[model samples]
Every structure is written in structure tokens, then in C-alpha cells.
Target: MDPIQGKAAGTAPVPLSVLDLVTVGEGRTATQAIRTGVEIAKLAERRGFHRYWVAEHHSMPGVASSSPAVLLAHLAAHTDRIRLGSGGVMLPNHAPLVIAEQFGTLEAMAPGRVDLGLGRAPGTDGATAAALRRSDRLHEGADEFPQQLAELIRFLDDSFPDGHRYARIHAVPGPVQGPAGRPPVWLLGSSGFSARLAGTLGLPFAFAHHFSAQNTIPALDLYRESFRPSAVLDAPYALIGVAALAADDEKEAHRQILSGALSMVRLRTGRPGLVPTPEEAAAHEFTAVERDFVDGWLSNIIAGTADEVRSGLDDLQKRTGADELMITANAHGGEARLRSYELIADAYGLPG
Candidate 1:
């Protein structure tokens, strides 16, 4: 089908990017998922997307990006120009020093192309969160996320407080020495706490509108209101992450996104599994309650033909005043997913 066209007439041209979960589709292996992620990153670069980020999710049958740092290294090696990083690394899951070192290594390898977006959530179920932390205490680590973020920044900047124990220990391959010293840090959030913190720290912020559509604007508002100028940013910089699935038409787009919609339903219903195909989703029997639940979950998604999706995105950008927009499109097959992005890129007039 021919791609639809649209122009953001009144607003400035905003950068487009991608956030991938490395989703494993029905009848697909994790290896295939990772490979497809690499393929998509390459395509995104060719299509002029500004950055490509992988999310961290543990113990999920559907997501292969349990280790975003490792996966980012692979993606960085495979693609030349597109910036690669974690959509975010869940800060509470590991030690601050460890994360600093891992991302520091990534910067050493790819240099100016690495970004570090941090999140406080566990990124998994309660049991898995506990296991990842190697402690039965689940909530404690999350509560310490702010402190962890500070320490991570200090490590990356080689500026730990003199009295701090870690002050003497340098995060090896420490801060890059040129124009882009440390990997740019971004705070990822779905709520107000993270928004305020990111703003207070003067870091770039990314709000997850895909799942937390209700909180998107509020969080961004809080971020901007609380923002303070720092070395990293003189003004508040924000990006909104949205679920955007594009196809030949509205019906085709809706059909293609059924896999993701059904996956969300299964996840919320305590039966989280691999992403089901459109056929599988179509075949599943939904009770009235289930139908309602699925509809509510997918209400945030912007799915349609290229022009329709572009219009939705333009409205979102105008409403939020976001500096950039990151799209996440999940489909049952790699080709369909790629096509969705291609159509959106074409509609947005992203440079090749």
C-alpha cells in the first residue's frame, strides 16, 4: 500500500525515535527477537530516526531485553549512526556502581552514541524483582533509587564527594574526555515522583505515555515546573513515548496491533506470555469484562494509516510540547513491525 502523507505545519519539526522491548512473538525464539531488534535499529538509522533504545524487562516470556547494556552493545556494533541506549535500565535492580561501569563500557565502545535512561521500577513481577536484587526486601531498593541515581552520576562524572567511600574509586573508562564526556542521562517515568526528580536534577525526561497515558501530561508538567538548570541541560528537555502502529489503513493497523493489545490483556490478567499473533488474538474468547479491560488498555495507542497516525502524533506533540517523540510498535511478525515504522517515518518525512 502507498504510504500516507502529512505535515506538521504549525509546529517545529520534532525528532523521531524508537523504543523497543525486544518482544518475542508467538512461535518465535528469543534469539529471533534480538536479531529482529538489530534489524530494526539498522532500519531506524537508515530512516533518520534520532535514537534507538531497548527496554529492560526480566523474566518475561515475551521480552528478550533483560540486559539492555549487553543488547545495546550489540546494537551499537550493528548500526553506525543512530544513538543506542536503554529505554531505561531499572535502577533498583542493580548496584549503582555496576550500572555506571556497564554503561561506561558501552560509551567506551561506541563513544558519543550512548545514552543512559534510568527508571526506578523493578521492570518485572515481585518475585523476579526480589531475585534480581538478591534480597527478600523488595521495596527498600526502589526507595533508594534517587540516591542510586546520584551515585551513578558521580561515578560517571568522576566527581563523587570527597568523604564518600566510592570517591576514591574511579569508574574505569571513566567519563569520555572529549566534547561528549559522559553518556547523556535521561530519566524515564510514568508518574510524578520521577518527573520532579528528573527536573530537579536538570536531566532530560521521557514519559511513558504508551501505558500510562493518563499520567503523561501531568508528569511532564511536573517535570517542567520543577526543572532547574544544570550542566547537562539549560532548559527542560522532554520526550513522550507513545505506542504508534501504522499500516495501510485503520482496519489493517488495528488488526496488526491485536498482538500487542492481547499481550497487555494477558499481562494484566496474570497470564503474561509471548506476544500472540493476530489470528491467535482473534480466536481468543473475551468475556464482557475482558473486552472492556482490553479496550481501556489500548485506548492510549495511536493506530491507523500513515497519515492518520501522523495526525495523532502531531496532536500529542502539540499538547505536550515534547522535544521529541519515540514510537514503539509491536506486531506478530518482524516484517509487519518494520512496515509500521516505515509508514510512520514516511508520513513524518524523516530523512533517509
Candidate 2:
């Protein structure tokens, strides 16, 4: 892949990527969700998407990607070129050394086609997070994310300091040489804290605009302003993940987005479950409060015809100066979701 170049006035098409939550839709099983995810990854690679990433979410009936490393390995086996990674893996749920080994093993398998995008969030509710961490205290590891990130990097690079306690503990299948060296590490954030940390550490940054659109520009600005040259990156590089749903027509796109909108409503109300079908979303009645919440949530989503969505994304890139755009789409069914990506890819003219 070529280094990302700035687009003047955002007229030039930027690299596009996919961030899959592996959502298990209404009446669908986790098995079916995984199958759809793998199929989408294969299609995404063939359609010229730069990367196909899976997100981590624990104990969520709607989301099947509880273990990004495991899903990434499966994706790596099915796809050839598109980079496979965690859109991100929530680092607070596991130990740094464990994540290093998991990703190190993935790098050994896929060689140059692996990335490690790390997040500080627990990726689950308090109960589930505690279960995953095997600790009673929730968020105990979150505060140590920066230290853990640095340690994980050292493990991947096999560059632990000589006198460090973990210096002698080498991660098997450690850093490779040439183009397939240790997988690139990216810090994922929805706030300025992580943005500044990524900058200070000189790592690539990916902001979650899909869920936190209001903070996208601020986080990106902080990342760029605080960046310092390091061995991994000489200049600041950032990607913004957005929620997008494209269809042949604007009405169809809006209808498809209703399912996700309904799902968000349920999630925010502490009743999260499988993503409902369009029919269910259509029949469901919403109170004024729920309507307002859903409306505000939907405001961040780009839903329209191919051309319309493409225009919105272009404007977003211009405003954020994002090096790449990672899109996540959820629809009533697998085919509609796939079509959304197809339409966006066609509009962007991505080469296979």
C-alpha cells in the first residue's frame, strides 16, 4: 500500500476500509453472523477496500466478534490481500503480553497483512468486563492502558529494555524483518486523551466517528498537534471510522438504516439485543424521548443513495483531513448490508 497523500479540496478519492461489528441480526445465530462476516471480508478485499477489520464486544447478543484475534485469523484464512485486524481490540479486557502474543501469532500467519488497533475501553458492560478480566473491579486495567500499550509494542518489536522485568520474556514469533515486520499498531479513540497519547507515542490513530462524531475533528486535531517523530511513524497519520448506509435509492437507504437506528435505541435504553429487521423497526412505537435519542444518533450516520453518501463522505474527509475512511454499515439483512458497501465502493471508484 502506498503512503497516504493529502487530497487537495478532498476531490481525490482516499483509501477506504471496513469496520465490521459482526452483528447478529434478528433471528440470526452467531454462526450465521461469522459466515456473513467472512463472506463480506472476501468481497471487501476483491472490491479494493484497504482493510477489513472486526470489532471486539463481549457478552453482546447483537455482536458476534467477541474475540477480534480469533475472528482475524479466520478472516486471514479466507482473504488474500486486504489487511485483517481488530477495528479495535479493547486492551483493558486482557493483559498486554497476551495481546502481543495473539497478534504476534497472527502476524506470523499472515505476514504483511496484519494490523493491531488497540482501544482503552472495556468493550462491554461492567459485569461482562469483570468476567472477561477475571477481576471484581471494573476498569482496573483501563487506567494502565498507556503503560500496557507501550509494553505490548516492546514485546512485538522484541525491544524491551535490558534491565526491564519482562526483558527476558520474549513473545514467540516476534517481530519479522523486511516488509512483514511487526504488525503496525494503531490507537483507537473517541476522545482527545487517546488522541494525544497516540501522538506522543508516534503511532497511527483511528477515531471512532461512527459513534462519537462530535469529537472526531477535536481528537484528530489533538493527535496531529501532539505528534512527535518515532521509529514507527515520522508524521501524524489518522483514520476516521464512520457509519454509512448506501443503496440504489435514497428512500431505500433511509429505510435500511431504521433497523440500526432501532438497535441503537434499545442499546441506549439498556435493552440491547439482536439488530431488529426493518419490519420490526417500522412497527415499533417510540416515545418522544426515544425518538429524540434515535434522531440524534442517526444524525451522525450517512444514509442515502450512492452519490449522496459519496458526497457526504468526501465532505467529511475534507473537514477532518482524515488519511483514510473506515465505514461500518448495518442493515436489515446481509444482502442489503453487502449492497451498501458495493454502492459506496462503486461511487468511490476503488480499484480491485
Candidate 3:
């Protein structure tokens, strides 16, 4: 298949909606992290971002966003435009009906702006997963995601389940009148298998490029090459999540990214820290191999000045043919993080 291209212009345009203020913060409150996220979303909208999404993670002290739906609803209530949704909600962790109800209600409250990005992984350790399950529903947690997905879709669609017991059931804000009966849905994955499944099922795809750098390209390729248009999407629509950190200079940007980097390092090494202040990160001794991995990870990351970021984003879009770009900025403090996104918006000609 030929490569997909972005809209070219004589001048640079802020490519896609800017996503901001994600934290994994050093010594910060969950409330503080969430408020910071909301502030970034508001700024992005003012700057002309297209959407704002929150992620879900469980049992991580460094990361506060455990319930994406709850936070998304908070963001939806605050913003008038800019679509609000989950970067992804891990499907394996919750019942399909419950997720449908949560996001379905969100769609009802905010009418035309809700996106449900679903992931199949269990976002936490085995013990947490066990704690989240009900005893009677013990067997229900098995890998029935495909079936669960179908059930969620049916629940969201007022016309689904024709003549069945659930047919009479109504998903309140039932039949949200829009381009489609329900809000748009995208499958989130970091591997080729998911890309193929998403393609076969006829849904848009969003790759977790922020974490799974190795699988990013192959998965996208499979999705695009195998894509067959469905009722909801006429062609393949791809979105990639990239860790974006920007500062006045490359040196400073690199420093800012260390907090998020250390957070990941802790996860990998079983010694997580509060999003480290740059000083703390730079002071820590990293093994030669650890430093090499960090170097590779940083190479995959997009950080530097605005012009640098624009050029990188252009190349990334060209390489992946992604329809949308979700920029996850895990800069240390609230102010700096917001500034990074502001720079991106300014450089790319995104509104703000």
C-alpha cells in the first residue's frame, strides 16, 4: 500500500488537537494532577485543540488518573467544544455494561463530544484485577473482549438487540443525534493483532506509540493495508500517542522529560519516584545499559524547540499516515507543562 499523507500547506498548521498535562508529578495530589489536566485542556481549546483525553491506570502511586471516565466527564462539563474522552479505558478491568453506562451517560451530558477508546490489557497487577472482580462473575472475566465489545456497542445503539431482552432497554441520552447514532469509537492497541482485529471490525485505530515504540509501525501497517470501510468509518483512521516535551532549548527539554522518564524507570525497576524534579533525575546514577535504554527511549520521544517539534511531527505523520496525533506531555510542573503545549500550538499554528 502507498503511504498516506497529511494536508500540506504553504505554511505550517498545528497538525492535530494538542493533548496535554498528563502526570505520572513529583509529590502531587491526584486532585492537583486532574486540575492541571483540566487547565491544559481548556488552554488547548482556547489554542484550538480538537480533543482532550485522559488515561486509566491502577495501583500506581506516581500516576493519578485511575478513572478516565470520571475525569473525562469533568473535562466535558468545563469545555464547550474540544472533544473529551479516554485516551483509553482498559476493557479487561471492567464490565462492558458499566463502561457503556459511564461513557453513554457522558455522551448524554455533553451531547456531541465523547470518544471511547478501548484497550484489552488489564491495566494493573494480578492482585488488583482480582480485587476488582466479583465472585459470582469470576468466570465472566475470561478473554471475551470481542463479545464484550459487541455487547457494549449494542447497548449504546438504541436500535440494536432487535426483539431481544435488551432490545427494549434504553441507553439514556439514547440515540444521540449526530453523524452516527452514537459517539465515535476507536480501538487502542500496541500490537499487530489488535490492528488486524480493528481493521476487520471496521473501527478507527489508535496506537500506544508512547509506550510500545517497537510495535507502532507494524501495527499501523497491518491496519491500513487490511482496512475495509465500515458503516461508521469509510476509510482507516489512525491516531498515535507520542510523548511530547518542549522547552526553550533541547537541553532544557531533555531535562524536563526526565521526570516522566524516571517514573517509567521506577516502573521498570520496581522503584518509582514522584515525577522527579529535573535536578533529581540528572543527579541519579544510571547504569550504562539503563542509560542506553533511556537514550533510545528519548530518541523515540519528540522533544526540543517548537521548530524542531514541527519538523519531527511532520516526519512522524508522513511515516505513519496517522489521521490524528495525540501529544502526551508529562512535563514536571503545571506551569511548564502548559508552556510546552503552548509552544507546540504556536509553532504548528494551532489556535491559542
Stretches > 4 Å off in candidate 1: 1-12, 176-180
Task: Score each candidate by Cα lDDT.
Answer: 0.85, 0.85, 0.75
Stretches of candidate 3 above 4 Å error? 1-15, 19-21, 134-142, 159-165, 176-181
Clashes of 1: 0
* lDDT by residue (tens digit), candidate 3, 1-352: 1112133222443236544435747767778977888888899778766677777877777777788877887888789877787768887778777887788778787877788888877676666766766344434554677777887888777656467877776666556344333567778888886688789888888898888988888999999888888887778878889888778898989888876776677777866556877888899898887787688777778999988887888888778777778888876688778888888878876644
TM-score list, all predictions: 0.94, 0.95, 0.90
Which candidate model has the greater TM-score, 2 or 3?
A: 2
Could you tell me how far off, in angstroms, the CA of residue 334 lies in candidate 3 after the best superposition? 1.5
**What is the alpha-carbon lDDT of model 2 when measured against the actual structure?**
0.85
> Candidate 1 lDDT, tens digit per residue, 1-352?
0000112222326778899989999899999999999999999999888788999998888899999999998998898877888889999998888988898889888977888999999999899898898988888887888888888888888887779887788786775344345688899999998999999999899999988999988999999999999877888888889899999979988988888888988887778999999999888898898899788877788999999999998899989988888899988888888898888888877665
